[model samples]
Target: MQDAIYAPHWNRNAHSVICVLRGRAQVQVVDDFGQTVFDDELQQEQILTVPQNFAVVKRASNEGFEWVDFKTNDRAQISPLAGRTSALRAIPADVLANAFQLRQEDVSELKVNMERQGNTLLRPSRSSSQWRAIA
Candidate 1:
């Protein structure tokens, strides 16, 4: 799990309360302005609440991360901010370029790279370049 990441995502209609079962993870919650709402290292037994539509991401520690979460909606729906099942993949490269002020090639590179990577639980390499800065 050292290379594992929960990926950046947001619940459409549910709020989640998560409790770490073991290991440690750096949890980050961001606002619409791309500002950090909460950024903390969660250890065993620690808990956090992610509000509905609020983006969240988790990076595992060397020992890996384990957690359990409950959502307000029984059939929770999630929209990942990165990876194949993300809006980034659905967006046209030209639109991405215009929105982020990036070159078309750069946007294509970002999207293509992420499309090859699955959504939800991802195990990105240490050297992998993340395009989270753009969106």
Candidate 2:
């Protein structure tokens, strides 16, 4: 299997937990409608939890990134209680672009990087509207 990389964003109604499987990841979980809550770099096999809404996670560029996401919903098989939560939110392109340390040239390079490492698991060209609903 290959690693997955993505931009992170926050949502008020969703909560998610990410567990690293192989490589490194960067995460920022914030509950504030206007402030930074938590920020750090997570190495291999680390686990992070987002209790409230508005959290962001981005896979580091220099390291291979692989992780599993456990999304939550009230009607799902594993529902979260009052203090628990679940859901996935789309990270805006502008916000995502800001978090990464790359120029326009890197976009093509990112694909090259993935292709060389056999990590092209996500089809970024597809419309977000057609993607599966994860929560």
**Which candidate wins on TM-score?**
1
Worst 10 residues of 1 by lDDT: 126-135
21-95, model 1: which lDDT tens digit per residue? 999999999876778999989999889999988999998888999999899999999888888778878888889
Give the CA lDDT, 0 to 100, for residue 89 in model 1: 86
TM-score of 2: 0.47
TM-score for each candidate, following the candidate numbering: 0.78, 0.47
TM-score (C-alpha, index-matched) for candidate 1? 0.78
Task: Output the number of the lDDT-best candidate.
Answer: 1
- Candidate 1 regions with alpha-carbon error over 4 angstroms: 94-106, 126-135
lDDT of each: 0.83, 0.48
Instruction: Estimate, for each residue in 55-113, the C-alpha lDDT of model 2 and write its tens digit.
Output: 46464535567777666654323221111132111333344356665464543444344
